[model samples]
Target: MDQNKPFVTEFLETYKRHPALWNAKSNVSKNKHLRNLGIEDLLKVCQEKFKDANTAFVKRKINNLRTVFRRELNKVLKSKTTGSSVNEIYIPTLWYYDLLSFTTEDESGRVGISSLDDDTELQFT
Candidate 1:
């Protein structure tokens, strides 16, 4: 077996123990809440959603994830306004575990996951 497999497995197991980290129902519910909001309102919603989660660790992780989300959305909006290609946007090099499962509407304004599906949009709000 690979030397890193056990460590990786343990990490995944530890992560799974946190319900708020990848709760699909919660994600979908939040996505619904986000669908009607504009960008700034969306950022506010993301900040508020995880305010009451059980642990400081989880709260901090959620906050970090929210920061990435806001940054990505800002990039997308800037590119759109400048009439630049959306492909110019790039994902940050940091890892946020499976928190990347959130979804974002594409440049044409359709709400679907794209090749860059970093979940920057759906993860927080």
Candidate 2:
């Protein structure tokens, strides 16, 4: 196995300059509402959704989750602190990004797109 040198500084360094470390395209979310929300909101939603999961055993499965979350969250904050204009949070490299785009079926079940560009007028069909 190769040693992952990415986090040598515990990710204390800004990742914006690193292409492999910071690719915004990786974090596309299909749930536009959820995608628009920041990380804190996302966590709150997750907490609420899993509120009833109070089993100690099950919770223990995520023993190191908080630390990992904290580290990742801190990295995001740092990124913003350094003047990153990227309003939407993208996933880390080599990770899956939730698709934010929505598709619809036309009269013949053919897929249709809302709009691909920034021009909002074209999105309305």
Candidate 3:
């Protein structure tokens, strides 16, 4: 065991569960590909690996770790794609950016979908 680990120990423990390995090869096969390896599902799998040894606090801890990576990745992606700003743009509702799914959705109950109109498009929650 290395001391002063880069990640919190709980996550390391979570990572250790079930030989938690993935690679591009796993996706090349004629199967579900990485759907089972979705990030949130991976997080849940991490939770399950720890069993009751870890709690929701650990879940938050791990999510925070993920959030940091999401932020940095978003920056790189945004820089590559470029963005536009108008004096004013109408959103018409509260919106959330789901980094995991790359989807955006309205918090308020709404039935319509929207577009970014930007060259780079990401899926929204």
TM-score of each: 0.33, 0.24, 0.31
Residue 38 local lDDT, model 3: 39
Query: Which segments of model 1 are wrong by more than 4 Å?
Result: 1-54, 85-125
Expressed as tens digits, the lDDT of each residue in 1-125 for candidate 1 is 36544443443344444433444444533564333222333333333443443344444544555567567666656767876666765444434333343423222344665766565565555
Model 2 clashes, total count: 6
Candidate 2 lDDT by residue in tens digits, 17-119 = 2222223333343444433333333334334445653434223422333345445556665887777678755344311111101111111344678655656
Q: 78 in model 2: Cα distance from truth in Å?
A: 0.7
Poorest lDDT segment (10 consecutive residues) of candidate 1: 34-43
lDDT of 3 by residue, 10-99 (tens): 444443331222222332222343333433444664555455543454446546655665565565456555653542332222111222
Better of 2 and 3 by lDDT: 3
Q: Roughly what TM-score does model 1 have, to 2 decimal places? A: 0.33
At residue 58, candidate 1 shows an lDDT of: 43
Candidate 1 vs candidate 3, lDDT winner: 1
Weakest 10 consecutive residues, lDDT, candidate 3?
A: 99-108
